[model samples]
Target: MMGHAELKALAAAALLSLGALAPAGAECSRDIAVPVALIGVSITNNNGTVGGIYPEALRAASAKAGCNLVFSVVPRARLEVLFEIGKADILVPASRTAARDQLGIFVPMIGHRATLISVQGNRAPITSAQELLDKHELRVAVVRGYDYGEQYQALIKELAKQGRLFQEVDTVAIARLMQSGAIDVTIMGPTTFSGAVMREPRVAGLMDKLRVEPIPELPWSYSGAYVSRRSLKPEDQAAVLEVIEKVAKSSVVMEGFQRYHRADILAESVRPR
Candidate 1:
């Protein structure tokens, strides 16, 4: 018999295969809507339009695949809802989970780990979520819709219950809160947290006052694209998924990420998890 890890892998493979075997709609739907948010380098407003590393890479992929892709600004919560209901075609920069596996075919795009970030005055290297929980004076800010797996869920649940959690709509807002000293800590990837802070005109210096450390309970997280099962025509969906899988490691994503992160972290961001 297969071990527990192997059994989980087999179950996951079975779930993902459903995307390929699912029946495609007969209508040729080329107009695909992708949701966007102002979070780090993933999505932001550029020249009055949605632009960022994610959009940059995705736009290039869609163009190459002959897919008519449209980017619409949507909050994280509503974004999930739209995709689940078949109103959204793609979910880029979404953290993958087993529950989400039933929704679409997830193609991993980048590898990043959740980190603990706080001001310089506080403690460094929080051993676990429980450690941070003990610091009653430290207020935590969390992006409302992000799912960083089970450990994160438990941490934020306690934070919410204690009324010490300040939920924000996006990472940009969380970064601002960090700078203003309204939030003592926030947990996220280094690329995302730094990118969000640097996007502001004068908050780049916020990094100087920040203390970043690994959270033992929070492990590696992969951000990727999920092609909705009910969105595109069969041929178009396959083409889009193939093109994205390739370009996700190409210059489209790499150079776009370089615009917001250091060379080392960018390498780690795109590293195979």
Candidate 2:
């Protein structure tokens, strides 16, 4: 029975009241009053995919924990800064290395084993690490900052002794370099490189032409949730770690490996040849 103008005014007033009462931070629930921002590698193109599997997996995990989770896709440089400055609430799929641990506490429950290695079976498979020494002039592409980790630093030092020509570039750039034949070798996680190649047919032949050699004694990456001590109290940090561990053990995470193709997406999302 209310007039149109009265109803409109009522709606506006209600909206303004709701806005005033809303929480200051992104709210997942009223009971657990803590802000969370998840940092991960930025995705350039999502292909209608809703931010890729890593983010998707974290979303599922956060939901299980009854926490509101927000995502910030950042470069490795910025990510390091955020953790250092106490801005990052959580870091997903973080590699466990001593250099990184110095910045914050790395939750091992979420750790995943990944690496940046050459794609095998391109033309001839690289059988041994010594082959790198023999191919002195081989052009190598690697992601910057990734080379400095404790586990990876040794590989870089060894490659340096071999006099390999390594060019540092972004992840996508590395893939493009391989596809253009500008670089003879590039590093990629098996899952990422695989997804990229699957999306591009020509890369398949290039894969046959290249050899993927797992860098040996090289520390396989262990990814997990990491939190900045600067941003969280010990109790809150411990709670977040608990959430990560609990979600890691859940059926959703364990059973969805095949569905996610996490390993393949990581390995193949790189340059073809």
Candidate 3:
């Protein structure tokens, strides 16, 4: 099977060939506009703008590529809708899934471990997926559009069928719901949860009330920039991929992740091919 890097190279070459047929100066250039849609809420503040390791990494890559990039923060569902309609050019830090693969090209950027958080005083222990599933009374909260892998996704579906799931708009809302005791437990990436706690004072204040634990059975998944195949021309897709591959390993991007305490989670490179 072709690996991600190999697939990317193959796609780039094919795209470049098609790009040659376009009018002169039609390739990805400074004049070309790139619309980047970011899913999820802002975690940190950057010069009055949303500061996130993923966004910072993307900005670095965009600068390196000399592409004119515009950023918009939207809910995950809305972001998907925009991508499907060819209104968005890119989605930063998107997870790879069979459904998403049909819509765009995913270039791996980082890896994240899904974690479970619950009220500190809760005595019930949830050490594994089965344990959590056994507790039918526990209300588990999750972000609406998150892809938590096939197994977990299936488990979530089962939970939903049992009326034990709470799908919220974003991490902040999940955190807020947990704080208010509206939900029994919630699952999210530690880095994401930490970023939210750092950016929002209300969520930060509830830290002591929450307990975070890793779900070891759940495998780590890579999150990356998903370039819209429907919206961007082949040359544009290749250019964006080139930029992401280059800056994804650069110091600037690493520093951005470090600032958010996500250095360990950042993917060192596209999964080796």
Best by TM-score: 1
Error of 2 at 134 (Å): 3.8
TM-score, candidate 2, is 0.66
Give per-residue lDDT, candidate 3, residue 266.
28
**Model 1: CA > 4 A from native:** 1-29, 122-124, 249-251, 263-273
The clash number for model 1 is 0
Q: Candidate 3: which pairs clash?
A: none
lDDT of 1 by residue, 33-96 (tens): 8876677767888776998888877776566555667898888878888888988888878778
**Model 2 lDDT tens row, 1-273:** 999999999999999999787633233432222222222222323543335445556666556555656654455556666766667777655566676676677765322333435545335555444665567767666666553255456555677666665645345556666777687776545544444554456565544444445655443545555766666666656656666665556544333334545443434332211
Q: What TM-score do all the candidates reach, one by one?
A: 0.82, 0.66, 0.77
Give each model's whole-structure lDDT: 0.76, 0.53, 0.67
Q: Rank the candidates by lDDT, best first.
A: 1, 3, 2
* TM-score, prediction 3: 0.77
Please estimate how well model 2 matches the true structure, expressed as its whole-model Cα lDDT.
0.53
Candidate 1 lDDT (Cα, whole model)? 0.76
